[model samples]
Target: MASSASSLTGGISAAEWDARVNLAAAYRLTALFGWDDLVFTHISARVPGPEHHFLINPYGMMFDEITASSLVKIDRDGRKVDDSPYDVNPAGFTIHSAIHAAREDAHCVMHTHSVNGVAVSAQEAGLLPLSQQSLGVLASLGQHDYEGIALNADEKPRLVRDLGHHTYLMLRNHGLLTVGATPADAFVAMYFFEAACMIQVRAQSGGGTLRPIPQPILDGIKQQIGQVTRGVTPGALVWPGLLRRLDRRNPGYAD
Candidate 1:
C-alpha cells in the first residue's frame, strides 16, 4: 500500500474520499465472501472531482489486496491520472467507463465472475425466479449477450444500450454485473444475484421441481427491501459494516 501523500491532500473531496473507502471495502468483502475471480473482475467508483474520473483496483492485485490508496485513478478513457506504482487495466475499465459515462445515477459499478455467476450465465435458461432471493434481482434485471472480449472500444455503445435502466444485468455466457446509485446498492444487488444463481444451481442438481415465486409477489419483495432498509439506500446502510469486516481481516485497505 502506498503511504498517503501530503501533496495530493486537497485534491479529492470528503465525499470522494468516502466513496473510495467504501469501494475498496467492497472489493475486500467480495474476496472474503469468495466472490472474486483471482484478479480479473473489478468494482469501481466515480471520483468526486471536476474531471469526472473514477477509481479501480490496480491490475496485479487480488481483490482482497486492494486498498483505498492503492486504487488507481483514471480518466474515462482509462488512462491513469494518479502517480501510483500500479497500472490500471484498460480492458477492465472499458465496461465500467461506459456505464459511468452514460448514467449519472450510477456512482458505483461492480462486476464479478464467481463460479455460480458464470455457471448460471452459461445455462440456457439464465436466472430463474425460483427463490425469494431471486426476486430482488428479477425486479429490475436485464441481459446482455457476450461479445468475444470486452476490450473492444466498439462494444461500449452496445453494452450501454443493453444495460439501460436496469440494476442487475446477466452478461450471457460470461458473468454478472450490477450498478448502483451507491456502492452499497451495487454490492447488495450482486449479493442477491449471486445467491440466486447458487440456489438455482443447487436446485437443478437435485433434478426436482423448482417452485418459483409468483410475479405478483415481486412488488412486495421490492417494497420490503425499501421499507426495512429505512430508505437509507442499500449501499449506504451496509457499507460501514463491510468496512469494519475488512478492518478486522485486512486493515491495509484503508492504508
Candidate 2:
C-alpha cells in the first residue's frame, strides 16, 4: 500500500508527498468528526519548498473520499500546476489563496461550516469562554463579519485583516476557519474551535445563566496550553492518535 501510494505522486519530492498525505488525513478526519458541510468548505496545505504552490481538495468530492493522491496541486491563482482530473473550488481559492500568500507560517488552512459552528457564528456574542475547550480557542481567536458569499476578490483583504495572527477565525453567520504550521496543527486547532462552539450551543440550549471563565484564566491560556502540550503544538502531541483513530474507522486517506 505504501509503495502504491508513492507511485500515485508521480515522483514528487518526499516532503510534498508527506504534505499530501497529511492534508488528505485532515480532510478525512474533518468528515469523521462531522465537521464537513457536504463538499462546500475546504482545507488546503502549502506544498513544501518555495514556489507558492498548494494542495486543495478536488471540487465535488466528499471529505471522506479524499486521498493523498487525489488532492489537486495548484498555484496561488488556484490554477492546476500538475495534471489532474479535478478542479478546485473558487470560493476556496479566494479564501485559502489570500492566507497562503499573506502568512508565512500558515502552512495549512482549514474552514468548516458545522452545525454548531454556524449556530455560534450567528450569535452576536460569538464564541464565549464557557468551557476549557473555549479557552484554547479564545486565547487566539478572531471574528470576521459576513460579507456575502466570499466569492469577491475584494473580501480577501478584510478576511486576512480580520484573521490577523489569530489561529482561530469565526466567520460571522458563515463558519469557522483555522490556520497552522501544518495540517496536524490546523486540524487540531479546528477541533478545539468546533468543540468550543458545540459546547456553547449545548450550554445555551439549557436556558440557564451562563458562566464565563474568568478573564485572568483566559489570559493564561497560552501558557497553560504550552504546559499541557509540554512545549509542543497540541497537534504534534495528538496527530498520531488521530491518524490511528482514522485508520481504525476510515482509513485510506494516504492512498
Candidate 3:
C-alpha cells in the first residue's frame, strides 16, 4: 500500500496529480454528503491531454474508499489508458465523456442520485426557485430526458445537446449533473444543486404556496455569486474547509 501511495503520482504530470487528489477528494466528499449511489453514479476529472483522457472511480469501490492511486484513467472511447487493478466503468463514464468532449472548459463532471436530487428530478416542473438556493441553480440550469441508464452510446449526442454550455443539468427522472473547470468547482456546483433540490423537496412537503424568487433577482444571480464570493471562485473559497473536514475523518483519499 505504501508502494502504491508513492506510485500514485508516478508517470503522471504535476497537473494530473493535482487533478487526481482533487478528484479523489470529490468522491469522498460525495460519500460524506450521502450522495454516492454505491459506486453507480460517477464523477470524472479530465486529464490534461489532447486525447481527452479522464480519471474515474474504479468500478466496485465505494466512494468513501476511493484513493488517488485507485482512480482509473480512460480515454473518451471508454478504453483504459493505464495498468490498474480495477476496470473502468465504461457505461457509467459515457455520460461524463460526452460532456467532457463537447465542452472544452468542463474539466470535471459530477453526477449524483441523492434522494432529494432524484426526487426533484421526477417532478414535472423540475427545480422551482422557491428559495435562493433554487434561484441560483435556475440561473444556469439545463434538463435532459432519461434514456434508460446511460448504457447506449447512441444517446451521447442527444445528451450533449441537452447539456450544451450549461453548468447544471437535471437528468429528468434520473439525477443531477454539474460541469466545472475543476473538481472543486464541480463539487461545489453539485453541493448547491443538491441543496437546492433538497430544499425544494422539504419545502414541498409542507403543501403550501411556493414563492418563486423574482425574475429580476434570478437574472442577477451570476453577479450575486461573484459578489458573495468576492470575485473569487466559490469552489476555491469553500474547498479548503471541505478538505479540512475530510482530513479530520478520511485523509487517505489524498494519497
Q: Candidate 2 residues 1-255, lDDT tens each?
A: 113465766788889999999999999999999999999999999999889999999998899999998898899999998777777889888999999899999999999999999999999999999999999898888889999887999999998999999999999999999999999999999999999999999999999999999999999889988988999999999999999999999989888
lDDT of 3 at 4: 74
Residue runs of model 3 more than 4 Å from their true location after superposition: 1-3
Better of 2 and 3 by lDDT: 2
Overlapping backbone residue pairs in candidate 3 total: 0
In model 2, residue pairs whose N, Cα or C atoms come closer than 3 Å (at least 3 residues apart or on different chains), thus clashing, are none
Candidate 1 C-alpha lDDT tens digits along 1-255: 453733344676778777777788889889999999898889999887678899899899998877677788888888888788878777789899999999998888999999999999998889998988898888888888998778999998988988899999899988999999877889988998999999999999999888877778887787888887898877777777876877888887665
Clashing pairs in 1: 184-235, 185-235
Quick one: best lDDT, which candidate? 2
Candidate 1 global CA lDDT score: 0.85
Tell me how far the alpha carbon of residue 183 in candidate 1 is from the true structure, in angstroms, after superposition. 1.8
TM-score of each candidate structure, all chains considered together = 0.94, 0.97, 0.96
Comparison by TM-score, 1 against 2, better one: 2
**Which residue pairs come into collision in candidate 3?**
none
